[model samples]
Target: MEPLLTAHNNEATSIAQLTAAQQKLYQWDKTIAAKHLYLIENKDTPYERLTTLKKHLAPLDATRQRDLIARYKALQTPPRGRRVEEWLRSWVEITNMCIAADVPETMGSRAQEDFLVACRTINPEYGTSGLRDLIDLEDAGTAIPSVEDYVSKFTTYLKRVLPLSTGLSSMAAELDVSKPQQQNKDGNKNGNKTKPQCPCGLKHY
Candidate 1:
């Protein structure tokens, strides 16, 4: 808890660069945006899907709320030698964003799983870690002025937790190979070998 701002600055820069996590989150973000989630919430087209997403996200969201409440309660008592939660605005936002990005992750879809699976994009210069300090006196904390402070922290958090890639690319690649079409579920026409069954144990020929 080095002043909420500097807690993570010493972290290695490489940790902030997106490997596959940001790509995943970007994909989910695209899906959510393309569907216009808010507009379709009450309509029939995307309502069910959006509702399902929210349902899946509820527990994660609730846990974040619960964590805040617990932290608040802890602050009221004032731990003898620890950083207070009331001053870690950036820290709070970062934690919340981590949970927010986790929404797509629990759905079990390949895109949701891989997209932004890790939020490695948060750089120190603009992130919240530069705001909070380690000293815990009763003095008030510095108020973050620029919007970039919040944006950097949350963006990095979102990217890190974002889902992995949509697996569609790999699926498409597999489909692109020119394998002889199975004449039927029974076997290949040339009789080299029978077609492999799908995961469901059913021949998809």
Candidate 2:
């Protein structure tokens, strides 16, 4: 006796009026609804009489169903400034939506493939080979894998790749060159005196 059968009076309540949680509990997608309707009508299950009596309930709204495959196809990978943790949080949100919508395309393998595809677009030089090179490099010195290995490894890869992708290496070189010039200016202002030792008792010179 599932709660869906006895919890509510069908004559008084419509399916559209059911809460999202209730719809999920009853597995109320279109295909599932059809199957259940058929079973109820044919008196196929031992609970057939109870189900048939409630068969007049309204169907879930077709428009409320999401096309998860299409949504993922259109999903853009977050830009470099966005942390991988934020991106993963967003993916988790999407997964919850898919489960609520009863989307069939939300399998873990499909998610992993989609994640890889999104990541490849971030660094096309990786050439979409499942990020093998980047993964291997990140894992090179690590002996033990943890539950968060996937996130940690991918995060390290992004940190390494984003600098290259965003011209940060050249920017860093320019900054490095400017530092000597600024130091010379400061040295002149100080009349060529050795700078005072740092508070930590270390001399920069």
Candidate 3:
């Protein structure tokens, strides 16, 4: 059974009492939740259940997005080769939820579309039509394709996308550009401060 079913006694635990993983798995996307809840209620196969549970969504707010993205990158294990693959694969899945167009309007669809395009951009070898088909699925809110039909190809597609170091650097740079700047208590963005500088390339004063 999924953690959700066993999360807590329904009557005793308010929605607020669910764990972080439970909240993310069950509350992140309504479309996803509906599908998964049905499968759980009907005793669907484990594969069906697992695939529907999307996690670490990078959130909608730019500030939260940046924090989570950075933390995910920072906390990765064996931080080298396979690390990058794992990260991109996760984004592919996470973006699929957004692509399902189930995200809040505040989150918008552009980011999801842009993300799929990005995966394609990293791997021109994936072929345009193949990428387009995936986009089409996302367009129809069926981004989670049948496991046997698309999972293998999708795995291969992502496997060929980008190297860990390259993907990490690129993703980080993109997040840095897009995420809202960190603000100080003084209401300064990124602590907009200057320091006395020598030709040592210190911050400008």
Candidate 4:
């Protein structure tokens, strides 16, 4: 890896190896960022999403992380270069911002299902792959209409649907009133008196 880094400094060498390595690093960084963003956006799948990111990024050596950092420094100035570290940092910032905004978590199976439905309704191309692709482009500064535009639209949609999703879950919990237990006719607790039903429709002795 050090050899590849030095290869970039050499004018004689083609640097093809270094370039390929950097590209792979960029893809990995993008994937990590996308997973974090997905976790932040779809809180229901945080564990699964984060696990995927860890799995993908685990294989990268320390040298790669260092190389990416150096490349990112180079891209920080104007005429930004495609660097893995810079993209990952951008993703981190975005995720932090979303977290700071206090986005609600999508809890429970029913809530998650409803959230997925809402996301699809808001944008047909919002599956994991599509979302990752968008996030990758946005982080790399290559996306059309700008990342801000895409995020603004997405945030607006989430704001509208999240409350409704939560409300539905709340309503479901409330309305699923459990039926009262029926006493055995043969075993009467009190002579012949019938049990009175509580406000929740549960019979109490």
Better of 2 and 4 by TM-score: 2
- Predictions ranked by lDDT, top down? 2, 3, 4, 1
What RMSD does model 3 have?
A: 19.6
All candidates: TM-score: 0.22, 0.35, 0.27, 0.20
Q: Could you say which candidate leads in lDDT?
A: 2
Q: Model 4 over residues 1-205: C-alpha lDDT tens digits? A: 1223232333424335445654444333344444344433332243654676566566654455454444434322322222322333443344334334332321112222322233343335553444565456557877244333433454554345434433222221233322345767765756675656899988666
lDDT of 4: 0.40
**Minimal lDDT window, size 10, model 3:** 73-82
**Model 2 lDDT, full chain set:** 0.49
Residue 4 in model 4: lDDT: 31
lDDT of each: 0.37, 0.49, 0.45, 0.40
TM-score for predicted model 4 compared with the true structure: 0.20
Worst 10 residues of 2 by lDDT: 165-174
In terms of TM-score, the best-performing candidate is 2
By descending TM-score, how would the candidates be arranged?
2, 3, 1, 4
lDDT per residue (tens digit) for residues 80-119 in model 3: 3324446555554544543344444214444434344444
Clashes of 2: 0
